[model samples]
Target: MNAGTTAERVYDSLKRTLANGSFAPGARLEPARLAQELSSSATPIRDALNRLAGERLIEMRPSDGFHIPRLNEIGLRDLYRWNEVLARTALRMSRKSEPTGGHHIAPIDAADLFGFIAASSGSGEIVSQVASANARLAYVRHVESSIIEDTADEIGDIATAFWQRSISTRMLIQQYHKSRLAIVPTIIELIFQDTQTIR
Candidate 1:
């Protein structure tokens, strides 16, 4: 493939790896190791790392180079709250718009559910912001499932409220974030535990 294609390919691959929580939190990302693992040169790996940093999926330090961002309890709570705000903004913006059809029940993937909510706002910018936040929260949500019981039920309720455009939609959203917020400490501990065992 061409140079641009190679870079894009590496970027996509690296983005998924980072989003999936392949590396431990606060772990330094060695370009050479990633280059060997990705079967690409260091240049493309660096490029991809730079892109991921811009998305806040990873951190880049002048002194230490690239590392997975360690999510602290406060930062994690803030992210959850910020996403709730974004989703609520979308819901408010779309209030006058009629809810679309296809309201059948299905397994609610957290990312897709949030993305759908954001898309309802009819604002591309909100959709993009929610998408980014969802990406960052992907692994944390996975950890949450282990810590927080009834996750599927919670997501299902949120999805149902959203599709029906019920008056309770906003309340459900707030509850969802509050549930996660309540367990921020436990969630952070489990995340680090998983990092130690798995990564």
Candidate 2:
């Protein structure tokens, strides 16, 4: 393949890896070494790193290269809060006019559910952004999930309620916040984990 194709391929691969926390929080990513790992040249590695950094999956420092960012709990909470609002708003606005057959039930996982809800906004950009965020938080979510009470069923139930018209949008949003708030301790532990801290 051409250099450009190689770079694009490398970018996709690295985006997945970085999002899945393969590099770990605060890990240093050297372009040359990463290029070697991917069997590509440093140019493509640098290109990929820059792209991931743009999505906030990795941090790029001038002259210091790429590093995995330490999770900012406060920032993350704010992001989650707003993302919920957007997704909830989008869901509320669309459920009335959109086709009901397709959205009969929510996805089993939180990320997919959020993506599905965002898709209701009729914006491909929202779906793509959610997918990227999903990748970055997949590992952390997995860890956090293991220690916390699983509420997948509750989320599904909420979706069902919405689908059946048994609940209002306001109620759905409130339950979403409640389900998330229930896992506070697990998230707190995750944020302070030694591996998650910026070195």
Candidate 3:
């Protein structure tokens, strides 16, 4: 394949690994090792890492190379807060007509549900930001499912409210973030344990 294609492919793979918490927090990402494992040259791996760093998915240091960002308690809370704000903003800006409840009860993935809410705003910028936040929080949400009993129900409620155009949908979105915020420590602990186990 061409150089551009190779770099793009490497970028996608690395983004998934980082997003899913495959690497432990603050783990160094050596492009040479990644290139060997991925069966590509180090150049593309470095290129991909640079792109991910630009998105804030990976941290790049002049002397230290690349690493997965370690989200502290405050950082985690701030990320969640940012996502909550983005979701609420999207909902408020959406001019979509009231839902007819045609597909209100269909099963929905949590990330996709969030995407739907964001896309409703009719703003490409908002959609892009929400997608990035969702990716960054993907593994955190997975940890939530393992620890929180009502995650599915909570997400489902939000989806239902959106489809039904309930006035309380906004409230459900707030509650969702509030509930997650309450368990930030537990989420972090589980994520750390999970990454440690795989090491």
Candidate 4:
């Protein structure tokens, strides 16, 4: 394959592996092993690792190797808060800019969100899937990070519950148009503080 294609393949494979929890936090990412597993070459693997490192998904240690960056509880909370803001903004933009030629623009459902993410198999699909998956993965990463930090057990379940409730609240806001946008950040802060306290 071409260099670009190979790089894309490497990037996608690594992203999927990271997303699915295959590469745990602080796990070393050996370039040779990655190239072998992905059936690519070191060049493409290096390119992919660089890209991931740029995104803070992985870190390049001095005199060491690439490892998944570990997030503390505060970092996890900040990540989740960012995700919530971005997801809400994306949803609002999607709703406002939907095509008008009798094209139905439905609010994103949980199943649709999950399926869109599951079907993402390449870098091309990343932009389309990132909003949802980032929102979801933020929670997952928060829980896992919390566990590693010894801040909490069963934090993933709490994050999942918060996400479900947020989805419902979004639906209600769309249907009723009664909720203020200011409430979103408040809700996020409340949930974050509550989770921290519960831990």
Which candidate number would show the highest lDDT if scored against the true structure? 1
Clashes of each: 0, 0, 0, 0
User: lDDT of each structure?
Assistant: 0.84, 0.69, 0.82, 0.52
Model 2 weakest lDDT span, ten residues long = 94-103
CA displacement after TM-score superposition, residue 165 of candidate 4 (Å): 15
By lDDT: ranked, best first: 1, 3, 2, 4
Query: Model 1 clash pairs?
Result: none
Candidate 2 residue-wise lDDT at 161: 59
How many times do residue backbones clash in model 1? Answer: 0
Runs of candidate 4 exceeding 4 Å displacement: 96-168, 171-199
Q: What's the lDDT for candidate 1?
A: 0.84
Give the TM-score comparing model 4 with the true structure, all chains together: 0.56
* Per-residue lDDT of 82 in model 2: 60
Window of ten residues with lowest summed lDDT in model 4 = 173-182
Give the per-residue lDDT digits (tens) of candidate 3, residues 80-111. 99999998998899766743234454435567
lDDT of 1 by residue, 68-177 (tens): 88888999999999999999999989845544544554546778778888877899999889978887888788888887788888889988888877999999999999
CA shift of 108, model 3, Å: 4.4
Per-model TM-score on C-alpha atoms:
0.88, 0.78, 0.87, 0.56
| Clash pairs detected, candidate 2 | none
Model 4 has how many clashing residue pairs? Answer: 0
